[model samples]
Target: MFSSKTLAEMDRNIAKYPPEQKQSAVMACLIAAQEEHGWVSPAIIAEVAGILDMPTIAVEEVATFYNMYETKPIGQFKLVICTNLPCQLSHGEEAADYLKKKLGINFNETTSCGTFTLKEGECMGVCGDSPVLLVNNHRMCSFMSHDKIDALLDELKSQAKKGVSA
Candidate 1:
């Protein structure tokens, strides 16, 4: 189910641990699969389990337990807004509402254009950076005011038009 390059990457990850501890590489292997496929599907989970010599349920638990791993396909850009109490106190809810209204999609839904997917995330370990969001689980945007949010949407839309990846 994975490409040669992806399997090679998984193999490299597996090599990081001792022979008897191949299961320790399960997370890394899943990440490689997700990177290649854009989401962790059932097939991917089984494949990773087979490769790491672990139970499928074990791999599934890891995938579902983490917010970073997407079990279903998502848009090109995944916007995860931290809606925990600290973030809510810092306008996180307002920001999330703004995004939902602007994109015409609620949390867990993707835009009609398939350009963005909105999700409410847990604390990202930066309570002080409340009202923060992540782009594709990588880029972090802090202190998201309305203006900043608008700017970000505009920028992402422009990038989408240009066939750019977020």
Candidate 2:
């Protein structure tokens, strides 16, 4: 379960709308819980259900349906790769192979350094930007090559070390 503060925030999420539309807060509530916990735990899903006045199964259904929400813990930099139609058509599998080799881990596994975790994804809705990866859920890496991926890892490591030292 989340702390009282998170529950209060969940309350405010639904309060913004009329009481009848509390279900609208379900997604936001799950996102909030996921953001706090780094992965949506069963308890967090139940709490979200309690917040939105929804059945636990309904919440679970939504959480499980979305690839964006992780049932298991992810790493610091979540490297999400696209394997949908467009991405696959445009070398997505090759990109995945490169990533797996470079990271020394297969899909759905985290690197030993704990810097990243690999996630094989469906359409990220950026089909045009096929063969894309999202780092830290903020930086988007697209049209990747093995060398480019290596550079990216180096840069991220440097940035993280800098932040730690600071």
Candidate 3:
């Protein structure tokens, strides 16, 4: 169910391990599948398991264990706010509350417009940059203040209107 490019990528990842250890590429394959499909559905999980020659449960374990992998469909912009101790010590709670009020959605919830998904996250390895967030699980936004969050939301809304992803 993956594109040829993704299959090729999986092949390359699989080649990294010895012949009998194809399962070593399970995470890579799952990531490729997610990149293609936007989320890891049961079908994608099964396809990954088939490609890795591993049990479906094994793939499921990896998918479920990792917070980075989206198990369900998410909005175009997934805003992950760090809520760990360091972040809490900062204005993380205020930022999250601001987001919730601004977007009218709680953590782990997607906005009604399907433009954003808010998630509570653990430490993103940047404790000093408290009140930090990750966009689409890739772009790191640090030291978010209220005004900065508003600017970001406006920018993302503009991007969404233009049918572009950030």
lDDT of the candidates, in the order given:
0.92, 0.81, 0.93
User: Which parts of model 2 have CA positions greater than 4 angstroms off?
Assistant: 1-12, 159-166
Q: What lDDT tens digits, residue by residue, belong to model 3 across residues 15-56? A: 999989999999989888888888999989999999888999
TM-score (all chains, Cα) for each model = 0.93, 0.83, 0.97
Could you arrange the candidates by TM-score from highest to lowest? Answer: 3, 1, 2
* Model 3 alpha-carbon miss at residue 25, Å: 1.0
Query: On TM-score, who's better, 2 or 3?
Result: 3
Query: How far out, in Å, is residue 21 in model 1?
Result: 0.7
Q: Which stretches of candidate 1 lie above 4 Å from their native place?
A: none
Model 1, span 92-132: residue lDDT tens: 99999999999999999999889999999989888898799
Tens-place lDDT digits, model 2, residues 25-136: 8877887787777889888888788878899999999999977788888776788898887998998999999889888999999988777799887676787776788775
Give the candidate order by descending lDDT.
3, 1, 2
Candidate with better lDDT, 1 vs 3:
3
> What's model 2's lDDT at 55?
95
lDDT for 94 (candidate 3): 93
